[model samples]
Target: MTDLSLIRNFSIIAHIDHGKSTLADRLIQITGGLSERELKEQVLDNMDIERERGITIKAQTVRLDYTAKDGKTYELNLMDTPGHVDFAYEVSRSLAACEGALLVVDAAQGVEAQTLANVYQSIEHDHEIVPVINKIDLPAADPDKVKLEIEEVIGLDASEAVLTSAKSGIGIEDVLEAIVTKIPPPSGSRDKPLKAMLVDSWYDPYLGVVILVRVLDGALKKGDQIRFMQGGTQHLVDRVGCMRPKIEQLSEIGPGEIGFITAQIKEVEQARVGDTITTVKNGATEALPGYREPQPVVFCGLFPVDAADFEKLRESIGKLRLNDASFSYEMETSAALGFGFRCGFLGLLHLEIIQERLTREYDLDLITTAPSVVYRIQLGHTKTEDAQEILLHNPADYPDPSRIESIEEPWIKATIYTPDEYLGSILKLCQDRRGIQTDLTYVGGRAQVSYELPLNEVVFDFYDRLKSISRGYASFDYEQIGLREGDLVKMSILVNGDPVDALSMIVHRSVAEDRGRHMCERLKELIPRHLFKIPIQAAIGGKVIARETISALRKDVTAKCYGGDITRKKKLLEKQKKGKAKMREYGNVSIPQEAFIAALRMGEE
Candidate 1:
């Protein structure tokens, strides 16, 4: 049995591009977890998109054997996690499995938005934190200034913080020593009934499904009958193992240890993340706490460019769900885009990742609609308690305004970190989006402001605008603040005279005209000239708010005249003009598929 006192489990947290993955590589090199030939930059970031974007998408866990300065060998598990706000749930699951955290900050950039958000999460989990400032080798690095910011903003003493440059391998040994001395060892009892938390999972053809978990109490072994309390499904363990930089079979993993279990479970949903695992025969008295099913916030419709690829799209998503369980999709049909699925995601980033994966992994051509948020509407008439409330995600299902007593939308609490010079611009942007300032503070030269903003406002090009105003110097993070009453109206677009359901959107009543005008103008640019004039109109409810017209293609009817008299040419031209007018009165305007998408994609990035 492993000594719990000599084992330490911890996670690395930081804002995106703050060198969290790079620091993990340095520590892995220092501990000799993998040989030089097997080691590479961002080793823990296994996804291609993650490596290309220089971000961590999924949390990675690996066990290391480190020899402390006191000549004692210790087991260290590094729970490398995603830093984006879209993956906050992933960060929380990682923190729950660790006894401590190494808060990594960029030496030159100081503390940003995600830095403070993740630190508070670590503190909330009651984990011991050790601040580490990375990228010190940069010419503009100011480690001293960052230490002070960490102390003042995060409320954590950084006098003992380690400063290192993962690029140059400086102070690598110091970081290892800090992990051994500063981070506390794991604490739990091995004698209790089995209680494990499933933190991550993946599917394999040979093994069916495999789950990674942290043993909160007792032990698990091969052939043990296990059951997930949240899923309520039982299975006999097929194999028990550990990731020692590579998979290695083990007889049993005791308390406070991180390991894997493949229990002949075919479905990934049965071994969901944040669920508790226990022995089916001699179960723990109760399940572990803090298990929550992921609730999707952003929604969109995805359809294939070719109708025959519908089955292929379904198969691809099923494979993806084997790895990503947070995203949900159902069969949905559209008049403009054809048959597709209505998919739900945690946020915009999550939706983008899933769509990109389907396109790349499955080699499928997909058409996606504009992303939207789920809405809560209170109907005017109700026969029962359940009948009073209704949830709507698609704009096509919107009811009459008279029937809706009130409409509510989701709101979020956002934390923005930016330089003091751009504070006024950011404040103006937030106020324009209906944000209510809750707290404002300054840490050294940086301004950290907190505001409560509507989810629809933030999800619509807010991040892009924040970067544009700050010139890429600002970082932001947010959490859902629940739904509240909103003055929202469904806006529709028309091509010629026909309404397009795919171009429908929900917008605030105050800015309806402005948003409508922009949509009509943008649609005019994307639509090609037809035989007859095409009118693009944007309407809120039954009232038209904006309009634009695209002129038809003109043809030279008298061009074939061969030395004809001037009277003959004039008569021919006049006759052709009348024909054009008649066609415009009775002919239909054919709009390109791209025009339908362009209207909904108007306004901003």
Candidate 2:
């Protein structure tokens, strides 16, 4: 068993594309965790989607044995965490399992918004953060400036910050040495009853459910009967192991160690993240302070294109949920989209990744509805003692405006960092979305601005627009603030006087008319011209705010009456008009799947 003082548990935290994974690869290489032939770029990113997207969606853990210059061999447990704001929950959980974090910053880019957000989280967890200025080999890299920025913005001491080029393996040893010496080792007693924290769990085809755990107060051994403190489900531990990028079986996982355990658990749901694990007999009486449940801020509907594939989609979603606990869904049938699940996500990126996984991993074609944020609807006046408040998930389920005393929409405090050249456009974009400027500061030629914006506005195309306007230089990170009263209304799209529940959305009143007009125009272009004219209208309550008409594909009933008298031709046309009107009343506007997809992808044009 490794001594507690000789073991260090730490995580690598940084902004997206700031070299967290690359640094991990270097560390693994120098420490001999993997042979040169076995080592690949981003070896921890095992998922195909993660590799293809070049982003770490899941936090990966690996154990490495390193011999320090002082001639002492140490055990290092490294948690490589995602940098995207959508995966902040994953980062937090990983941080909870570590005693320190490597705060990576792009040497050229200084510090971005997500860097600040993650640093604050690490500080909140009481992690001893070691600053690392990465990408020093780049021509634009300014390590001195980045160090100063880190000290000023994050208030972390950067005097001893290590400068390294993770891509070229520069300063890899220094980083490792800093981890061994600067980061404190976890404190726990092995004599106590087994008390492990379930850091994460995923389904393995052969192993069933493989749980990654951090032993807090005891040792977990193979064949031991373990009970989940939160779930109260007991299982016999079949295997105890640690990942050296690949699983290596262990006889026992001692206190202050991070490892994996398989207890013959059939489902990943049974092994909840942040649950306390202990021996079934003589288990600890009190459970560890587990993590807070990740709250999904954005929601949308995912329906299969083929109605028959609903069951397949359901199964695929269930399987995906086994790995991602933050994703949530419920069965809901729509008037236009048929049966589907209304799913909640942490953000748009989270929603996109999940949808992409459903399509790529599960081989399912899905149509996603416009993303929306949760809203609080007060059923009666606030003065009433028993005023009912309903949480609105779907716009189609919006309460009657008369009955709603006030509609409060979720708001977010957004931090944006961008070069000075793109500041104007970024500010204009925020203003267009009804965002209130909270603060503005300048850091070494870059503008760091804070805004309070409605989450609904950010849910749809805000990130895309921000990226485009700033030429991908701007980075954004946001946290949900409490809901505030807003003039919000449900905007519904009507095709031939029938409302399409899939296209309905809860929008703020100020821009509803323009938004409705935009939707109507887009739908008019996307929906094919039928035998009868189809009037696409956007309405709020009973009031039609915008309308577009798709003219009928006429057959020219009077084409053969060229030589006939005017009355004959007129009579033929009149007969055709009556038939068209009858068809309009009876014909079902079969909206093609492409139309729904294009209509939901609004603001791109």
Candidate 1 regions with alpha-carbon error over 4 angstroms: 382-387, 556-586, 603-605
Off by over 4 Å in 2: 381-387, 562-564
TM-score of each: 0.95, 0.96
lDDT of 1 at 183: 86
Give, for candidate 2, the lowest lDDT window spanning 10 residues. 380-389
Give a tens-digit lDDT track for model 2, residues 1-605: 99999999999888888988899999999989999999888999988888887889888899999999999999999998888888777777788999999999999988999888988999998999999999999999999999999888888899999999999999999999999989999999988988888888888889988999999998999989999888889899999999998899999999999999887877777777788899988889998884667788899999999999999999999999877778889999987889999999988889989999899888999999999989888887545446688998888898767778889998899999999999999999999999999999998899999999999999888988999989899999998889999999999999999999999999989999999999999999899999999999999999999999999898988778768579998898899999988999999998999999999988665
Q: Which candidate is the best by TM-score?
A: 2
Q: Write the per-residue lDDT of candidate 1 for residues 1-605, one digit (tens) a residue.
A: 78998899999989999888988888888888889999988998888898998988888888889998899999999999888889888789989999899999999999988888889999999988989899998999999999998888888999999988888889888888888898898878988889999999888788888899999888999989988898988889889988866788899989999989898887787777899999998888788888899888999889898889999999999899988888899999988888899999999889878988898889998878878899999987645433378899988888877788889999999999889999999999999898999999988888899999999887778888999999999889999989999899999988877888888888889877887898888888888888668888999877899999999887877788989689989999889888877887787766666666555555455
User: Cα RMSD (Å) between model 1 and the true structure?
Assistant: 2.4
Query: lDDT for every model?
Result: 0.88, 0.91
